[model samples]
Target chain A: MSAATADPGNGTILRAHRVTKAFGGLVAVKEVDLEIPPTSIVSLIGPNGAGKTTFFNVIAGILDPTSGHVEFRGDRMIARPIRTWFEPVVWVTPSVVAGVISVLVYLATANADATALAVLAAIGLLIVMFLAAIVRPRWYLRLLATAGVFRSSRPNDMVKAGMGRTFQNIRLFANMTALENVQVGMHTKMRANAADALLSTPRARAEEKASQARAREFLGIVGLRGRAGELAKNLPYGDQRRLELARALASEPTLLLLDEPTAGMNPRETAQMTQLIDRLRRDLGISILLIEHDMKVVMGISDRIYVLDHGELISQGSPDAVRADPRVIEAYLGKPAS
Target chain B: MRPDIVRVLQPIVIIAVSLVVVWLLLGGTQQFMNFLTLGAIYALIALGYTMVYGIIELINFAHGDLFMFGAFVAMWILTVPLGMTGAVDNPLQLTVILVVVMLPTMIVMGLLGTFIERFAYRPLRHAPRLAPLITAIGVSFILQNVIYSVFGPSPVNVPQVFPLTRFEFLGGRVSFLSLFMVAIAVFLMVLLQLFVGRTRLGRAMRSTAQDREAAELMGVDINQTIAITFFIAAALAGAGGTIQGLYFGSVQFNLGFFVGLKAFTAAVLGGIGNTTGAALGGFVIAFIEVFATQLGYSRWSEVAVFTVLILVLVFRPSGILGQQLGERA
Candidate 1:
């Protein structure tokens, strides 16, 4: 199932090294390490407020870690804040020093034209700094990245690098039709740009037709065979969940992160979703990282499980091993009667 | 009446009333033609305000000045570069010259818009909303000052390349210039609608507007999409500016201030985030202004426009075509 991608030397598809996220004074995810092997289902399970979602966010590049780094298939996805220290020194220091000198010279010499000249130079330097920070030319990024001093990855970057994700609370474009939602998910795969679209070129029209067909096929896979024309907001709760899964699949991601995919479904729907999840790994050969509160689904489908309690990884192993571990039991069911 | 019935009849009733008023006040095709031409220009400029606001939820106070700058660009191309001071009678020659002037002006203004967005607004994207707004006003002032220093405060004469050929239509006068202006505006607007509705980048834009994080997770390059939005909006404003110079025969540094206010008013009236709404709002505003001036309240026209704006805000807050509550998450 995992034969589609070249082996990354290591067996894992994703690796997080001591990732920590702090929101002001509160630490949400603390020094958590995780790995997802090729074409495997890995579950992160714990009681509510155990930092599972925060850890999920850190891995998906939605939130930056307070420290440490994440790697995907041997490529660095994110790194620590080395640039925060290095940028000001290289970009801002000269401008500030020039500004200060200009002020001092204006007071000491009382020559307005000279002061203006100095101010203009300072402004020019500041413009250069602004361009550097905003434009972020490839050479500058490569130079810093090679030195292990800077690495930045936005969520789009992660998606382009073969990662796809769904939210705990569904985030569909409510006004868009179901088919359009799926087509938008295939944004990275499309090639027609503004010019082609404006002119209605043959290639653009052909791509549009192809994507519509592909989008409908995805909808059918999720058991939504004919609901593609309905607005996403108009779908029932169960169908919306399925539609979200269909959208995530449209990205052709090598690794998929499902944040509580069956969070609000009934028993029958949950069973269906669980089967779908299993079939996804078996058929599509994509690794999945899941956060689940339902113990039955986790224990039934996960190849491995990690337990988190109060932002700490308490135990990790095969699902049966985790179910038998005392630390996992203590985290979920409290200490034994004494 | 039932709510559904009221919803169905409301627009029809408003249209009937507006037609009666326009017929009684304007009373002539000449004045109506003026309304259409003015409406077209306003619609083009209003789109810039509506689109930028839709994508980023930024008011973009500097957009009006970008239109003014565009007018200056056209002026420079026509007067300084091409050395044409007056209208060319050859229709073929005029058409060619118009194309020559418009393309560069629009492209230059479009690039300038992207530059401003990259420099001024992108840095404050994550800052509090008010920060980018202030930066927009600051950009507006800088644009005004730059134009003033170079061109001076007086209104500069522009070549009205579009000939004022008049013909009688139903007991009133119609100018070829008016027809040309309206045709161009409608054509560009249709092109814009097709692009936004059918293009890949356009879908990315709509998704980003709905949920930025979700769109990013779908692999939409958020920054590039935003820059493109600014480019298209500014380019449309540039076209509007070119039309203004050709129609009115003059350009000024302060030209954008009042016209921008009216175009902004149009956007708010039609619905700030909806493109069709902005275009509709522009024409409706032109009708009201034309009616007011024709009825001998020319001095009070601005007062009338603002009064209507305040009323619309007070009553419907969401303008005519704004999204319903259920559409928003």
Candidate 2:
């Protein structure tokens, strides 16, 4: 990256430098460098087996590069802190439960089960104890995860970080409603737990209501608001794709990765998605990295394009430049096409 | 169309039908009702197995042993002079004491789970499915052996603190102790489901369970989320263990071995990862025993339970309530 062009002072939030991966004999990703500056659209174009997924895997920490570094938001997502205190409540509380178990045992055995009726009576009491779990304390003691706690927040919290994604095959939480599906995508933004849900806390109710509103807004953005309550998998193919996008944007991610966003859509849906990708950049200032096979979709929406062949960056330039490159033509067509 | 009905009525129908059949065939309504509590208790342990497997897809073979550990921890306290029984005589005091005592055992075993995952499961995370599973068996062995070392091979009495009484009502016998077991077990299962389904860690769990790599890319820390999951599930097991120990008034070195196997069957029977399914699976297993015993096959009750498991696996393969989506190894 030119110090003058892709300046760190500017808003380049993600960076990968000469990243490479090899699997013993086969080189998966070979010295690929990428800079995803803020508020811009970039497309990584390659045919199948171009190692695009592997490259994606490396930056995302799903795979460690044999050589190179990945930095997100100026910090390594995998960086480990030396030390910190967590679980303030873990030990203090457990000892108490242990003490109580002991006492309960003492009393039960002190006189107990002179008859089968006694055993039956104990069983009855057990049910009552189970019922007691419904009680959600106003202050349910929560410990920071030894590894990651705020990190431990539900998938619904995805929205708070403004982050979301779509699977190549569209893996929506199948059991959830279209509305609930988007709501789960926004799970990170919610502030409630099972206790609150079970107890029906006013705050929980309000959060649930707010989540519904947010879900509706996101669905409407992708023209699926009407299908908000439907089963996601039950939707038409194109609609499911749109709903996936809507769900992703619901998190308001600063950068969105669309994996094969146009894979199964028709020309109409593809055209619609192209416009939506552009509108997202213009309207929300949200940057996006689209993985697409359709050259039309990639050329139509990408501000800049990078072509990959066998995990190596073969070309990077304006769409017109990429289209005219001999290597790019060969990578796609397997020969220079007239 | 009827999420509520399906969610609520389905379990009720299965449970009610089983309950009625057990009552009618067990040769006594009172006897079946009494056994219902046993189902509830086993349901508690099964819930632990199911919940843990639901998120991480690990059977936690040592979980049954964790329950055994809980009983011993409580027994250690019960045998002491300042035990809960002596300290708290009233109902409310007894309640407070119970929570206090059970809390430690749960935490200790929960940590034990975290350790198991960190030391055993973590290294083998990306290995073949059998790797972590085999480690779990190793853990089970280690825990049992440890128990043998500490408590001896013979059965140690599980001391009880709560005043328990068995009484007759309208030609039916009722065990207050059994009811307590039911209450505690149910409380744990419901509480856990809520935690997993609604909480942040729970969401992370679902996401990781779905696609761990994708989840981590979404800025989810899979390791931390998994550790938390193990902790919560083990804590639940600890509760079950302590309760069972105290209820039976005896825990041997091998207490968890048979029960663990039964609970695993229950986990599979109800649905591997479904929380409600686990609880349901537990009750189903208990009732199976009741009916088998009535038919003079009490000695083969274990065989009967596994037989149902084999049939279910051979047919549905997803258990009664599990989904194929989550069936991946």
Candidate 3:
């Protein structure tokens, strides 16, 4: 289904220029200038202490960049905070402000000044909205802090925009079937309102049926139609990995960030996953920013490779060129056998 | 009975023989049927607890209280000028219409269950399991007192007083009240069974019950699915409450106490997380209690129920349908 997957956007879709991340005293990633052009397979390969996962975490919005801002399609990405209680109170602030302003105008002009009052009310509402646009997030952040959820919104929310990720260790629902796993990834796109679902009306039923069909379709795309009915945990290790990819694809993302997709796979499974990744980039229309420890898999699929040694990119180039580079070989093959 | 029929009718035969013995002891058929009817009612409430536990892996201690609220609300509605009492010749028609009218109220209780899961259970979702369970107990206490404060402690008589009419048998009187209660409870239970077994929400619930994260990854909103489970349990309890009030003819603020424990025990007996098992568990407990009572052991009926529960749990921790099912990815 990812066939002819032309880049949906023109020009560099995501540009991370001079991004650095520090953790108190230690620098986790330093001066990482990168251009992630749309719809291309790009591999981030490195040794154990390479900070590849850390870099992926930062880009996926799990971690904030210590310095550099991420610009995607020219629009600055905003990291939205997870849900909190104070959100409801934050929502009504605009309406409350509008009410106060409208009342003040009414008291000043009396009922005869209809046109002026309307315009004043409209302007007041607009101002409240603008203020809300600025303040709601602040309110949410404050609430999250108070709620002890932990956030440094600047780097976090910024990272989340247009970026999604999967954990290194498989975190599949042990009891949920394979199909349901993929369904959860499409959560943000669900059109059915909560009220409609509870009501169980014909419209809601129709929407739900359609969603189920779509969920089945995604599972099939990953060649997991046979395992769809089985619980994810029950699937063999390789199938579980495939299930994770299916789930990732369900997000319908522009950039697919894979964290060790073939970490525990045998050669056959690794080869299959590599092909899937290549097909994903070519057909699914997603720019692959991948982290794989297996050099063979990396070299087999990577169009361009970036090698990191100690929290910094040591070398980067086309696969054959990077592989031939003495510096890249020194980083991995160890001082050229002394 | 033929050998094939005997194999199929084993439990029924045992119960039939037990009924005959009870008839001899109680001096008749009407009393035996009364016991049977009461068992059916408890089974209804027990079924709710089982269904909920089966899906979300929650004990839902407050379910019994939700049922109690159902009875109270139904009583309030019936007592008001809105419900008519006089033209109640057909108890089936009257009771059916009454319970049917109570659906919205039951649905409201379901919403309340959803709220409990959100404000109470959601925060404790990541914390230790014991945390939310304690929260559930706290909620139950709050609801009981809330009822006492609003409606008072007195037994509120349900105004649509359908007179008890016993259908006389070889030895006793099977009242219209008992018949009506048994009929409605059984019908609703079957209806609920069909709804849960065959529906999409039911599948979502089963999935959530399995593994919440996996379910969430599948686009099943964990919170939404949990809420739906709560709603279903709450609605079931509400329906049970309405039935209890109609059957017993009064609803007390403390009605949930006994019913809640019984339902819990029923859930345990049926297997905590098995929906069909919970319903069957309820009936079994009721039958055991009814038989114990007939044997001049009425005072120890609750003890017998607990003993049976403990015995079952010792053997099968997952309960009757403990199939180690899931919802995670």
Candidate 4:
């Protein structure tokens, strides 16, 4: 855990140390260490079934690592703040006790006057349990979690923590308008509750207006300004890909993860996407971690690349160095035909 | 005209034409007012159904039961605690009682909705769609029996606490209570439209409905958004229940069962996922029911509503305002 925060001056924005993920008996991602420095584009390249997506899933908090840790901006992704045992006790013990007491009272009262008292007591106990859960000290909570009250960070938490991603396939909200899709990405940034929404309070209204303006700005950034009102499903293939990128950017992420951004694009669309990726790095000044199948895109854009083979990082270096490595070549193309 | 502008105006024109035709057929304003009041109540309930379906695609069979419980809650508050078994003559006292009863009922029902989602629907989120549908029916029965056990099977007569003052407009007499209910319903509908169109959480809801995975990737908390949707929908249902109690002066344990089905029909009629459409569908169904009853088909009103639902499914499956089949957004 201390290693997670060891280097503040190194400019590394994300660090995954010995990260491993397993599904049942199958080890999908072996112990892998990787780092993405600030304002740099790092590509993770591999052949099919190389576990790139699994690795992405782990870091993105979509899947929890069986072992090892992922730290983003010096914060661990999975935290066991309380002992595991404490959580159950805090959550369940009062209810069990109340149930027992209620049954005893009911029996003692012969279903009479005391039944009300028993109900009141049970409600009181439940309230106390809720209060304890909400007001307990962090250290005490962590101690309880250690006894098995574990809570894992989720993908939305990662997004709120300044990480954003797009899927391998275009996962844009197909039924939503392009502008609305981007507005959804701004969920964490906006602050309005149900009451505010129902009452149409001034603050909620102002926040809504600001979010719409920002959503439109994001659309413009993605070069889909005029198509903001168009449904995402109606967008062309290339436009849909860019719309996904726009939606991701609306989260105001410091680190962007793009998975196969150009998977189905033609040569012209692919080149255009490549340029947009370069511009994202240059203009936005945000660090990017990309998982791509196309070697040309990787070689042309990646400042540093990591090559995976059989769920293991076989090589890591600059584009030219990784391309020149015999192991990487063999991993991608296999042994020479002769 | 551009297609988008035409799309927006088409529904307005259709509704206007229908209203004019109904006006001429009814030959009187009183009947239309009655239909409007009933339509408002149905619209309120339909909004709940449409909202929950939009976000999670769950029918929430317990919703009608929630509305029933809301009526029961209001009844208890008025009869047992507030001691308002008869109509209050003082406007200020009436206002206070309405606020006291309505606010707590909405809150409690909203919380119950959240609880139902957490326990019943959330677990089956990833299961086959039919699984939740069955669970929803099960929940509906549980709620119905719970109410039956507590309140008995007899209809509880709700005291008409609302003022019965009538106002004459354009040779039509409209009760203040009816007008009030319609106004409240319209207010809520407008707020809902603005929220979904403009607010951040509303955007999250629409996105989640369209694509749950994509919404999560964009930092939208799918669970929280769904929970909020349930809360809002149930709260609206609660409001509708209160109005129903005041309007009809009686509530039965099975009140939700019939109303819930009607609301579901309304949702489908207005396009299940479209918010404003559900409201329109509710009013449309109300008009159909009222007209049928007036035309000496009182026994067949329910049949008529169902027939309309089937017709919509067969000819225009998307309902009146539904987008084209492949363009459901």
Q: What is the C-alpha local distance difference test score of each model?
A: 0.85, 0.69, 0.69, 0.82
lDDT tens per residue, model 3, A65-105 = 88886555554333334444555445455566766766777
Model 1 residue runs over 4 Å out of place are A1-7, A22-27, A79-150, B1-25, B324-327
Residue-level lDDT of model 4, residues A1-338, one tens digit each, is 11122335667888889988888998888998999998899999999999999999887877768999887887777733234345546656667778788888888768856777777777877656544443333343454545555554556767877888888888777777888888888888887876687777999889888888898999988899999989888999999999989988988888899999999899999999999988999999999999986778889889999988888898999999999999999998899888
RMSD of candidates 1 onward, in order: 6.8, 10.2, 8.0, 4.4
Per-residue lDDT of B158-254 in model 3, one digit per residue for the tens? 7656665556666466676666667777777766665544345555566567655444434454555666667777877777777787777788999
lDDT of 2 by residue, B172-245 (tens): 77666666767777777767676566545466667667656545544455666677777777777788777776
Instruction: Please report the candidate that would top TM-score against the real structure.
Output: 4
Which scores greater on DockQ, model 1 or model 2? 1
Looking at candidate 2 chain A, the ten consecutive residues that score lowest on lDDT are: A133-142
**How do the residues B40-130 of candidate 1 rate in per-residue lDDT, one tens digit apiece?**
9899999999889888899999998999999999999999889997768898998889899988998888878888997799889999999
Per-prediction DockQ comes to 0.44, 0.07, 0.20, 0.51
Model 2: per-residue Cα lDDT over A1-338, one tens digit each: 00011224656756788988899979988999888878889888898888888887665444667888766555443322212233323333444455455557657776443434444545555433322211211112122333242222122222233435676777665554577556656654555654475476888868777878888998888888789868666788888888778767766677687888888888888888889889888888887877766677899778888888988899998899999898998988887445
Q: Which stretches of candidate 4 lie over 4 Å from their true place?
A: A1-9, A22-27, A79-148, B1-14, B89-93, B170-172, B324-329
Candidate 1: the clashing residue pairs are: none
**Residue B112's lDDT in candidate 1:** 83
In Å, residue B212's CA in model 3 sits off its true spot by: 3.3
Worst 10 residues of 4 chain A by lDDT: A1-10
Comparing 2 with 4 on lDDT, the higher-scoring candidate is 4
* Cα distance off (Å), candidate 4, residue B17: 3.8
Docking class of 2: incorrect
Better of 2 and 3 by lDDT: 2
